[model samples]
Target: MSRIQANLLLTLIALIWGSAFVAQSHGMQELGPMMFTGLRFLVGALVVLPLAWREWNYLAGRQLALNRDDGLKILGLGMLLTLGAAMQQIGIKYTTVTNAGFLTALYVPLVPVLGWLLLRQLPHWSVWPGALACLVGAFLLSGAQSLEIGLGDSWVIASALPWGLHVLLIGRVADRMAAPFLVACGQFFVCGLLALIWGLLFEPFSGAGIQAAATPILYTGILSVGVAFTAQVVAQRYAHAADAAIVLSSETLFAALFGYWLMGDRLAPAGLAGCALILGSLLVVQLLPLLQPAKTSSEVLPIK
Candidate 1:
């Protein structure tokens, strides 16, 4: 797929995830965070299992071997996914869908920074300004002017770190692996297994609670996890990680809209301004690379 197609796919994923935020919020009403997370992702894993098997068969027919290192990386991604998802799930219980949605987007700026720091993939100069804007926006959105944030918002903010790392890791994995469904399946299964273990050990279990959350679990599991995330793994193969983050961040807008319509979420003026600033910064960050003139091989100077 072309970059444009990849971006469009990411946008669709954003919509699914944004709407899924409402389901997630409702899910916590009936189930503990770990239990809800575990059930949804395990369902997701089952949904993807058939497709992953087909992919494995295709690879086998071609006599291609999956690398051991890539398998390890997939496991690592599962851990990050679990941490990020669990934190966001827990946070959504205390915060409005609007707040949770916007705060979760903290990963947009983080992707480029983490890329630069860990992978030595230098971001455009615009990244610093954009990152600053995102931080200020998060502050305003979180009501930090009162000099404190609620526990939910704090968890949402913390989730961004792992979320950013997850995005970067997916980019790396996509570059190395041709089987997107397999990658998605492995991560979902591992995350589901770990979350289920945690839930069983620490969180109370009730079949009625699961039944109460059945609709949400199925919606998020089938569409959000099964379809959207797998699509992301495929799309990122053709898109840059930073660029994909910006597009995925549009989910914040969708979340706000859905929250307002479905859950009666209304943001204060400060929160509105914060959202605008974040969206503007994302646009600037996304466009800066395209705006800058590309240096020719001769124009490029060696870094000491």
Candidate 2:
């Protein structure tokens, strides 16, 4: 797969996730955040099971070699994902909506920084400007006039670290794993297990509540978790982590768009400016590399 194709896939993942915000909100109406998260990911694991099985069968005759450490990495990814989700959900309870939105988008910048520290891979020069642009856009779009840090806001900020790590981890695992579908399944299952355990411990879960949130659960599980996440794993195999992160961050943009269209939400002048900045950042990230001279072999970082 080419970089463009990989980026397009990432964009699609962003779209799916962006639109699924509605379902997420609806699910919370009948279920605790933890309970909803657990059930949805469990459903996602089930949704991916057949696809993973088919992929396994297809590779049965091939000389496919599995890495000994892939399982460990996949498990780590699931744990990180669960932590990120849990933090965001819990943090939202105590923070302003604007704070939650802007802080969650902090992962846009965190991804490249984590990649540099952990993998020694520095992004292209254009990525910094794009990331900053996205950050400012998110801040403006969030409608926050001042910055404040409460416990909930702190949790949200903390979540960005794991989420950023998750992005780089996906790139590394995708580079090494033979079966993306199976990896995705393992991720979902592990995440589901953790979420379920936490939900059972702290949140009330009932069949009636699950039934009430069934449609939202199904949409998130099937499309957001099953399809979008699998696609992300596959797409990151071809794209650089930084590039993929920039594209995936566009989910915030899509969320704004969907809010305006579906919820009768209106964008103020600042919000409109934020949207433009985000769009400009996307163009910078996507097109600047093409305009610049190609990197020599020594300049390009090899995937581990």
In order, candidate lDDTs are: 0.82, 0.71
TM-score to true structure, per model:
0.87, 0.77
Q: What would the per-residue lDDT of candidate 2 be over residues 148-232, giving only the tens digit for each residue?
A: 4367667767888888787667756755665767777888888888888888899877889889999998998999888776676
Across residues 1-304, which tens digit of lDDT does each residue of candidate 1 receive?
9989988888888889889999999988888999899999999999889999998999888987577887898899899999999999999989889989888877867877999999999988888999899888887887666878888999999999999888777756855687767877889988999998999899887899899999999999999888886676677778765567577768889999999999999888988988888888877876666554663111100000
The TM-score leader among the candidates is 1
What is the TM-score (0 to 1) of candidate 2?
Answer: 0.77
- Which residue pairs come into collision in candidate 2? none
Count of clashing residue pairs in every prediction: 0, 0
Highest-scoring model, lDDT: 1
